[model samples]
Target: MAAAAAVAALQAWFWNERFWLPHNVTWADLSGEPGPPGSGIQYPRAGHVFSAFPLALGIFAVRLLFERFIAKPCAINLGIQDSGPHRAQPNAILEKVFTSITKSPGGKRLEGLSKQLDWDVRKIQRWFRHRRNQDKPTTLTKFCESMWRFTFYLSIFFYGIRFLWTAPWFWDTRQCWYNYPFQPLTSRLYYYYILELAFYWSLMFSQFTDIKRKAAKLANYAKYQRLCDAFFMLFGVVFIVTRLGIYPFWILNTTLFESWELIGPYPSWWLFNGLLITLQVLHIIWSYLIIRTAYKALMRGKVSKDDRSDVESSSEEEDVTSNSTKGVLSPSSNGSNRINGHVGSGQWTEEE
Candidate 1:
């Protein structure tokens, strides 16, 4: 009941008219009936966001099916084996310490655990390390997960281009603010908005299993930078140049100042610009990491792992490296926080 009341209060505060429309504008002003009064034009509503919840669930269901039937099959075809990491040896004593207690027990704690398990301290440490690796997602799982996202963004990209190509706002920036908030919500834009929201919802629902590690691939890329120098360098250049160079001056300028000059100050306008600015902040933080990686990479002649995401742990690294001729970059620290410590993923570089 307390939770329910809090939710209700939040909804009320969020939907408050003064926080959305301009001082002279009320919800009623944009509620369909135009001044000419022949046809009623539907404007965007706060309730439209709520409608995305149901669609999001539906999209989530579709994503599960897509991964199972489509993505998994594709991964198998590409020679991505579905096998998981090596299992840790069975030891109830060490398992408890690894789980409820500490993953990496101190030397003294290891001595105590070693006695209970009747195993050497090194054996106990290996067990814990193997246990940690077991939880990490397999390459097959990562491929399937990323494939789902790739399909989604690709579809949305074409859809966005098609919609934008026909819009007056696409050609002329003035069309965006010409009629202001009174502009009617078209069916195409409505569906476009919902599908995008739903795709993100799919990610949020699966965030736990996936650990939502956005930079996992980044670490993989850094593993063999000599082979992927072209791709990795291109990715870094595009990421840094777009976010740090062009975004603040071109995109941010257009969203914050240009929008204000065209539409005048309004609550919704401020909210829209605020979100754009907040996203830019994420870009800046990630940019610093990318730059840091590039500088070290230039000096070291090899790229480092991403410091923004979870660092992979493995006593198996030596064994994994022995199989390949190329040298793997030094592993990043495992104690780092998630990218920006946020719900969604951000970019960052790893260092040895």
Candidate 2:
């Protein structure tokens, strides 16, 4: 819950680009020669219908639905299974299935059924154990599993003319048909920004003292954390430079109005330009925050109290010296000279 809240707060602060959608279609320069970027119309053309929808939806779906709701729940459950409760959460479900199997009269332990039933039960138990050990549910794993299960039927359904689906003319121009969406320059920039925000929240969640005990091995997270931060930093730079630097060229080289190749002409194109600027600016900010957070997280463990070894050693040395000085300064009870010379050398012949 804390992790979810942290992510929600970050989304509000850094990645709140929802306001840009309706505004993205607003006219920036109403008087300019009109035509959409490639077509000469005020609205999206049939060929470019897919481009009308932004890529932000895919990011949202992945983050909110798949990751937060599905994967996160499973991960948290598995993480809690190490020692919590007598039965790991999944075990309870597994036991129920086993009981159902055992209760079925058709699955009776007759001559040959005994061996087969034992093997089947063992397989089921093994699967449950494996699932219990995976503390985090990966999106890729779930996607791959779904893909594997569906691929055979999908292949059968589109056996002969599957190549038609691959054609750009028939497929959506936005590159978001069956595969994961939001791969374009505009969409991907924001996607990275979202990931940056997510990583920031993840690092914050890891900071909880109680959770820290569970995640002491930072090496597991350090690799991906650094990679994500580095990618966001680079993407942010590119976004800012591309949007600001190329806006003039995209504006000046407008032949779509003359060619009648665009629907929304300059007005629609300007909207895209404005949106690009806004998104890139936000991306820059998001990346900056992510970098800051990641750097802090990376240094957190290093700055911990474990570095007291040097101080402890020095204190111990000082204590020994102080004790020696006190012993030397103390007067002998019988007025006898104490250590008149160096103890090791033993060279003194008379007491001072």
Candidate 3:
């Protein structure tokens, strides 16, 4: 906590020196029409710097909770096992049984292993397990796997923006140019669209699937699950709205090298912007439905003791699907190996 506060103080001081310390810096200055690159925009302006602080803080806090409160014990379970071509070594599985009740030696406080009751122990356990067991890959590999274009392009875009913001000549030469494929801004912006849309969909899909995965198993750790979903939903909305609303205007304003095609020759900027808006709108609707389903789960009581049978059945089904996907067990392998019915029976199809 002390370390976090110290870092925050330093960040604030840096921003103040860069922007706020100047009497000219004001809300009006920051909010004013986007300045010609470096001209009016101070490096690490107070408003931009402070705005990023919350985003960074929120990610750090959630990561900490998942590590300490949720992940610690989950590491105890799902012990690392060989998975497949995903990594050089076996990895953790993240999925596990929540409780293993044992009788209290003292018979005083029910000997419940919550460490603290009222908290969703199961949710914590699962969270820890998933994060740990997740396929370990290089940053680029993971970025590519999760997002086809966004990660690398954004890195490039941000790097370029930083460079331009520092270069006096780029800022001074405010003259804009335009021509379609020849326009540098149009091409860069087009690349950004590919990545942003992919990332937005991936994020929404993960949240939606996660909600359904535990809806019927409230005893596992309902409260924590709800909290996780709520947090994700807030970010999801931010991503969808910001991407949709800004991308269009961003493309229109920056694609200076392209000839203003008021009529024919549909520009790459319009194509990308239109597609992103449509996709985000569709995803928003889909997320709304998923949220409604999660809300239903929130209303339920404790995970019923009777649900254990269902839980076990579900686990067996999941194992079958996993094995099938990995080619670990053949369908005709007999007894324990033989899974009846359709090959992809219990699992969601990749098409989804």
Q: Candidate 1: global Cα-lDDT?
A: 0.71
Q: Model 2 over residues 34-153: C-alpha lDDT tens digits?
A: 354744333222223333234434433444454445544554444422122112344454455545653222333332343644545434443434343343333333332233223323
- In angstroms, give how far residue 193 of model 1 lies from its true place: 1.2
Q: What TM-score does each of the candidates earn?
A: 0.77, 0.23, 0.27
- The C-alpha stretches of model 1 lying farther than 4 A from their native spots are 1-12, 33-41, 213-229, 267-271, 295-304, 313-315, 318-352
Report the number of backbone clashes for model 1: 5
lDDT of 3 at 279: 66
The model with the greatest TM-score is 1
Q: What is the C-alpha lDDT of each candidate?
A: 0.71, 0.38, 0.38
Candidate rank order under lDDT = 1, 3, 2
Question: Candidate 3, residues 1-352: lDDT per residue as tens digits?
Answer: 9999999999776545334222333444444434465554332223432333344444334444544454434433424222322211222221222123221122322234334334244433333333333433322222222232223344656956765676543443323322211222233333344444443444443343222222222212223545545544454456456554554445433432232432122334455545756766666665565455445545553222221122222223344454455333334433344423335555422210
Worst 10 residues of 3 by lDDT: 96-105
| Poorly placed runs, candidate 2 (over 4 Å) | 1-45, 48-265, 294-352
Error of 3 at 307 (Å): 22
Clashes of each: 5, 14, 14
Quote model 3's TM-score.
0.27
